[model samples]
Target: MAQDPRALLAKADKQASSARGGFSLFGGKQDKLEIAADLYTQAANAFRVQKLGREAGQTLEKAAAIQQEINEPDDAANSFVEAYKAYRKDDPSSAARVLEKAIQHYTLRGNFRRAATHQQNLAELLELEIGDIPKAVAAYEIAGDWFQSDNAEALANKVFLKVADLAALEGMYPKAIERYEGVARSSAGNNLMKWSMKDYFLKAGICHLASRDKIAFKKALDSYVELDPSFPSMREFQLLNDMLEADDGGDAEAFADKIFLYDQMSKLDKWKTTMLLRVKSSTTAPKPPLLGCIEEDDDDGLA
Candidate 1:
């Protein structure tokens, strides 16, 4: 007798169908995918036990494909995740592929938070593993909203810094300064804020200098000095100082001539003298730089 081979196949198919149905009981809408996944998982195990690895992988892949086609993205994502975990040690590319699938699944579901998390993971891979700066930047930006919402300001600031650095590398001074400003605004009163302000002032000063906006450059440089007196770039400070001293006969000359000569002028005296002189020289100047420094609201005008 032929031992009913047809009957055995029929029974296996029935069991697989029933397993698929069971998935719906656990969760609606995505039941089919879950059920299929479970059935495929069992089939994969049986194939493995039978020493048919290729067949096991194929069966699992079919389950994942079905879930994807049916729009059961979460289940499909989980399936790929499982497959990658099973085989990634032997093939690193498998992990990347699986993660991409998960990202797409989350994106399609409007799960931005999850998508952003995956994007950040992708950025790590692109930056450290693939050495792809543009790709990493794209991923980092994709996760920007998430970082902002999560109060991960430091990470957000770091991303902005990276953008600024990249912009500076590309010689886009305005864009770089914009990025630096973002970093400063995000830093607020934290230690990171102070450092970011220092960097921003320096970069902005350079941008102003490049544009030959002497007044703005001087202002930025002064802000930099105020923020970080011991800034690592002392040479830059000295260079700007020399430039100011070199002014032949204009306000710079007169200012330079009397610079910090006041009896009570401390090391901080230069900025004060410059401010007073600037105000005296231009009464209509909208507001003094000292306006920004004063945290208090008062009607006292430079007294």
Candidate 2:
């Protein structure tokens, strides 16, 4: 008479065992397996309602495994996602593990868009849950590539921007610049995103300056102008030019002045602010003034 999870799971286990025993007049083995899978799903939801997350997750995993054996990748992946949701609150690593299985299922189905989205989700879990920045960046990059290949440039750019942010934070300037440039070039062709191109180019320029490769930076600036002639007139481009001049002169004050003025017009985000600070630090000026000890009336000859 009990409707508890254990009782429901026991019923589902009986159904699954019957599925593998022999074909019956009611249904074939495959049909019985599907019924068992459906029962497992019901048990999983019951476990979830009871706040037994690990039990729910495991039950859903069993459903997913059965679905996978029946060549129902979509159902398998959906079950995996449900299991991941169930596990995330209690055991995030297990959530990530099951989510990876879902991604694999989606990839095997040639559903790259879904795969890319799950990849981004995995990246978020790695970043926010596990605190794995490098893996997060790598996951984001993979998502970006998948999105791009799927002709989902908008999604690709969004993911690539995350890649650039974390990559730059890790001092992977070249990778950041590449990602920013990729987004910038892609955005240039879209009217709605065109306005943000300057922002992307500015980020790429900042990464270049942070790398201290003046020749490459100069070349990139020229290339940007060629890529989008309007880029030369953009305030973001002008700010980068001024910052580059300040870097060349080794004048920290000049760099700070330019940044302050730009911030007045358009505030910089934390990432940009951090990168600019690194570029400003390349300057040799603004050395800390030595604390001078003033002899207060030492002329009294007290020694």
Candidate 3:
């Protein structure tokens, strides 16, 4: 005769309750913890056999938690990953939560590579599944920091770029600029990254212009010149300088036409094209008046 599924569940529950009682009596002794983990695993197996997926995942998570308390972090992480897999089919949010637990366990165990990998996974889940761009950015930044701490500069740079891109998409221009500048500064010291530094400087300058900070834009240009004195001879540098001068002269239309002509003659890359458009838009707007209200009224009553 086949055993009843409910009977198996009841037996598993009894074992779990007994294990809990042992834990209370023994105060997390190794034997008690081992017993609790075993009971939880058994309960999870019984739940799975009965097609109670949610219950099975929960029970497996409980087993994982017990492993954590017992200082078996590797076991805890593995069990949490298993629980995440179990929950993924029916409840993606729950699966993400379990994966977070797994990441925490991996981080606590000083397995930074695994932790960073899982953090990236969680970020992707938040972005794709939850549609939380801010939280996803934060997760990616944390992952990047961890990768940097592990001396994985390539991986760290890739993750940081994601953060910068998302920040820009979210309209946080200052943050995007800062991240771009940081990556640019880091890349400047590397011969392999020589070609990318100019692009980074260009991006940072473009962001400064987008933020409507002419002072910052000028400073960024100066910094670029410092980095590469030959920049002034470059067509990009000459174009931007001419645009600034045109804006100052209140002839933004002339600059826009000039850019259009230049673009027709030589197609610009996406970054340069977008940046020039931003510059044109900036110049179209009139500058704000420099002087505010006077403290004292004159004889003409001007204040």
**Top lDDT model:** 2
Model 3 bad stretches (over 4 Å)? 1-59, 69-71, 82-92, 229-303
Clashing pairs in 2: none
lDDT of 3 by residue, 186-292 (tens): 77778887567666666666667667788888888888888777677776676667666776776756666556555655555544555555555566554222100
Which scores greater on TM-score, model 1 or model 3?
3
lDDT of 2 by residue, 150-232 (tens): 99989999999999989998999999999999888888889999888888889999999999999999999998998899988
What TM-score goes with each of the models? 0.47, 0.87, 0.67
Collision count for each candidate, in order: 0, 0, 0
Answer with 2 or 3, whichever has the higher lDDT.
Answer: 2
- C-alpha root-mean-square deviation, each candidate: 15.7, 9.0, 11.5
Q: Model 2, poorest ten-residue lDDT window?
A: 289-298
Q: Using lDDT as the measure, what is the rank order of every candidate, best first?
A: 2, 3, 1
Q: lDDT of each structure?
A: 0.55, 0.86, 0.72
Q: Mind sharing the TM-score for model 2?
A: 0.87
Considering only N, C-alpha and C atoms within 3 Å, which residue pairs clash in candidate 3? none
Better of 1 and 2 by lDDT: 2
